[model samples]
Target: MLLGDVAHLRTGDKGDISQISVIAYDPADFPLIAREVTVARVLRHLSGVAVRAATRHELPDLGALNFVLEGALNGGVTRSLALDAHGKALGAQLLDLPLDGDAES
Candidate 1:
């Protein structure tokens, strides 16, 4: 299953950093997201982008996970030549991340 099947994403960027938030559709699904969506996994998933490092912040109360990715924007909107330098599309890409099939419905 894809992460988008159980959650939605929001994205933001500043300079060379990209921030993405994944919010579970059901609170019960938060645990699965938290367990599977680690920093390592995110970095691996977005390897095409020049992500130097990543950090995952769990927001259990909000049933969400926030990831901060460094060097993802290629140098931010004003600096990068990339079309989507702001990284708005990155969130949608992340939604495509595959989740474990054993996840509870």
Candidate 2:
């Protein structure tokens, strides 16, 4: 199953860093999201964009996972030549990440 099937995504950016928040629709599915959406997986998923590092911050109370990705903006919005230098579309891209088949609907 795809993460998008169970969750939604939000994104923000600062300098060369991109922040992505994945929030589960059902609170019960938070555990599966947290377990599957790790820093390693995120970095690997966005590797083509030159993401240098990633950090995952769990927000259990909100049933969300926030990822801080460094060097993701190709030197930030003003410096990057990429069409979406702010990385707004990155969140949508990440929604395609595959999750365990057991992921709840």
Candidate 3:
């Protein structure tokens, strides 16, 4: 599936509950980039962890993508992991995305 294809994901919140937020980003695909940082694919690549995900919207004008994820922090990776060590959560998520044109260098 294309990175932009993911729209929504469901995961634990507090007591088997989950929270969902629409991915946000700059018109320059900042949201897409941010979501990628937390994308399930990247998590799997880095530590073999799986995250739930879904696409929310595509801002073609700005060339950005928005996705919802489940239990983004279910793993200790969210708490015990350092930003540098775990990657900027968002950046780590985008590791496998095929973004083109005006990519945030």
Candidate 4:
């Protein structure tokens, strides 16, 4: 199943680190999100970006998972040449990360 089918994304950044939170639309879908939205998967999905490290933080009570990707900015926002320097672009791109089949549903 597509991740967008179960959850939505929110993103922000500080220095060269990008943080993304995947929040389930319904608590029922948290299980699927927890199982599929992994650090390895996110790294692969965002392979184009030079991510130095990634950490996944679970917020079961919020039905969400937060990923902290380090060195994702290429450089600090002011120093980076990427068009969307503050990481606004990554959030939308991240939504396309694939989920295997419809098993999670």
Candidate 5:
């Protein structure tokens, strides 16, 4: 199964940094997301992009996982020549990450 099967994605950016927020549509799936969506896994999934580091922040109350990525904007909107310099597509890309466990039906 895929991460997107159980959760939704939202993205944000600042300078050379970016954020990917993975929120579970159902509260029951939060624990599964927390286990499968680790910093290492996210970094690996985003290996095609130039990112310095990744960190996972848990928002238990909100049932979400926020991953803050550093040096991932290709030098941000002002510097990057890429069409989508804001990295809006990154969240969609991350949705392809494989889910490691049986994350609900």
Candidate 6:
């Protein structure tokens, strides 16, 4: 699932953090796919901002994982989201970043 869906997003202090409950596919599915989807959604919604790290956790009995997306925002500021005449964020300027290997999806 995308970070924009069913996730609580927080920005400030250290970085941008997103917490999501684990889905039905998480436990049996490949962790990479889930991580990739989560990361991509987070980065994309925030406009391709790189994350310092994302940690996943499985709750005791609830069977959910909380994902934390760190350092993906401009230190929680509005300046990075402002567009000059055009609709865009500063992170949008980095759209040309090349993707390598198997993470192209």
RMSD in angstroms, all models? Answer: 3.1, 3.1, 8.8, 2.8, 3.2, 8.2
**Could you tell me which residue pairs clash in candidate 2?**
none
* Higher-ranked by lDDT: 2 or 5: 2
TM-score of structure candidate 6: 0.38
Error of 3 at 81 (Å): 7.4
What does candidate 1 score on TM? 0.91
What would the per-residue lDDT of candidate 6 be over residues 32-73, giving only the tens digit for each residue?
A: 334444445434544545567766555534434455556545
TM-score of each model, paired residue for residue: 0.91, 0.91, 0.34, 0.90, 0.90, 0.38
- Any idea how many clashes model 2 has? 0
> Model 4 misses residue 37 by how many Å?
0.6
- The C-alpha stretches of model 3 lying farther than 4 A from their native spots are 1-47, 75-87, 96-105
TM-score of 2: 0.91
Query: Across residues 2-71, which tens digit of lDDT does each residue of candidate 3 receive?
Result: 3444332222233211233323333444555555534443444435333455334444554544444444
Off by over 4 Å in 2: 101-105
Expressed as tens digits, the lDDT of each residue in 1-105 for candidate 1 is 889999998889988999999999999999999988888777777778898888888999999999998999987778998887565688888888889854322
Please list the residue runs of candidate 1 whose C-alpha ends up more than 4 Å from where it truly belongs after superposition.
101-105
User: Of the candidates numbered 3 and 4, which has the greater lDDT value?
Assistant: 4
Candidate 6 residue runs with Cα over 4 Å from true position: 1-15, 25-47, 77-79, 82-104
Query: 3 or 5, which is superior by lDDT?
Result: 5
lDDT of 5 by residue, 32-70 (tens): 999988888888787878888888899999999999999
Against the true structure, candidate 4 has what lDDT?
0.85
| Candidate 2, lDDT over the whole model | 0.86
lDDT of each: 0.86, 0.86, 0.40, 0.85, 0.86, 0.40
Pairwise lDDT winner, candidates 1 and 6: 1
